[model samples]
Target: LLTVIVTAAGLVSSELRSGSAALTLAKPISRAAFVVGKLSAYLLHLLAATVLGTALCVGATAILFGAAPLGDLLQAVALWLVYVLLLTCFIVLLSCTLRSQLGVAALGIATFIALSALSLLQPLAQTPVGMADVVTAAMAGTAFSATWPLVTSAALALVLLATALLVFQRKEI
Candidate 1:
């Protein structure tokens, strides 16, 4: 998440601020093409880094602990990748509107925290309470019992990315 936000969220804004956007636009590439190309490159970079990092961590843990849960680790990493992709979409979208990478990063972190907190609603509601909590807890637990936070995050990410693409298309270079 930090890597995606730091490196990708500033892709367009940084270029524009540096006056390189105009030069790039002067080329035959359309704005949509540019956005797609840059986003693709960033995603590819993310994939490579994530794979390498996961491999290193797994190897280190196996060597050091001798009891690494490789399957569980892979599952966790896959779920985490979903999160990274979602966050990347958000950061890219924010970059379209925000001029400063710092601002985007701050907002991105805050957004992540807020979204993550949604998962707690279930556990928090489940906490024992004096009678009034019983109904609330039941409701909260049932609401998400059939759903996963990752799915929710993915949906939100897709929406954010689509909105960002629309906004970026209309935004002034």
Candidate 2:
């Protein structure tokens, strides 16, 4: 979350407020390419942080939880990276549109809260139709669970990037 807000707000808002944004905007590069390039750099930086953080988090979990399953811990870390990248696109997009650091930060944090809700939505959407039925239902299990999450998240990230490119291109910032 800090990665998203800081990168987005610091990049666009500073330039926009200082009147230097026009120089970047006036560059010959396509806006989409510009956003893509910036996002790529941020992602590279994030990947490094993710690697270090995940190692520490998992190692700590291993100590606290006892006999932590290494594979599962790694899987959890990978999923987290996907989630972070997904949120990054939103923060960057809103920052591009609003051109205010505070606004961008608020938008990023708000979206974080919203999506964290959505991540829990599958469970919430399940309810017993009959009063006698259990309120909780078990999700259908599938071998695809091993792979589908990363794929689904990657696809969504692509959509967000496309949307950001389209919106950012038209944005005055």
Candidate 3:
């Protein structure tokens, strides 16, 4: 969560601060394309890091514990990836709306904490904020369905990305 917030907090604010966004916007490319390109690049970076980290952790666990449950670990990691992706979209949206990178990061962290706290409620247990519990259940090899969390997280991510694009488009740079 910190990684997502820190990385995305500077995605646009830094560009705008350095005057790079103005220069880029001066080009023929559309603002939407620029925002999407930034998001795509970050997503690729996040995916690669997640894959490499997971592989190393799994390898180490297998060596230490002798053949752990790969299915359960992978399932938990998949759910985690979905949650992180949603977080990235949200932080990106914050970056678009806020000029200060620090402000974006602070707000992102606050929001993450708030949602985590809210997840303790039974009613919100099925939301994306409760993804940590679902991930824990998966890792523990408990029987639980991850369908709703995955679907909701993905849907929220799309909404966030679209809203970010809209905000960036109208932004004065």
* Index of the highest-TM-score prediction: 3
Record all residue pairs in model 2 with backbone atoms less than 3 Å apart, i.e. clashing.
Answer: none
lDDT of 3 at 116: 81
lDDT of 2 by residue, 1-173 (tens): 56556666655556667877677768787777777887888889888987888789778877888665565546555555666776677676776677678888877877666655554545522211110111111111112232444455567678878887888778775
True-structure Cα RMSD, model 2: 6.9
Off by over 4 Å in 1: 123-150
**For model 1, which pairs clash?**
none
The stretch of ten residues in a row with the least summed lDDT in candidate 1 is: 126-135
Candidate 1 C-alpha error for residue 125, in Å: 11
lDDT for model 2, please.
0.62
Off by over 4 Å in 2: 56-68, 123-149
Please provide, for model 1 over 1-173, each residue's C-alpha lDDT reduced to its tens digit, 9 standing for 90 to 100.
55566777586778767877779888998777776677779888878988999899988988988876566556556656666777777887888787787888888888766655553565533221111223233334432221244556567777877787787778877
How many residue pairs clash in model 3?
Answer: 0
**Candidates sorted by lDDT, best first:** 3, 1, 2
Q: Residue 94 of candidate 2: its Cα lDDT?
A: 71
Of the two candidates 1 and 3, the one with more favorable lDDT, higher being better, is 3
- The local distance difference test score of each candidate is 0.67, 0.62, 0.88
TM-score: the better of candidates 1 and 2: 1
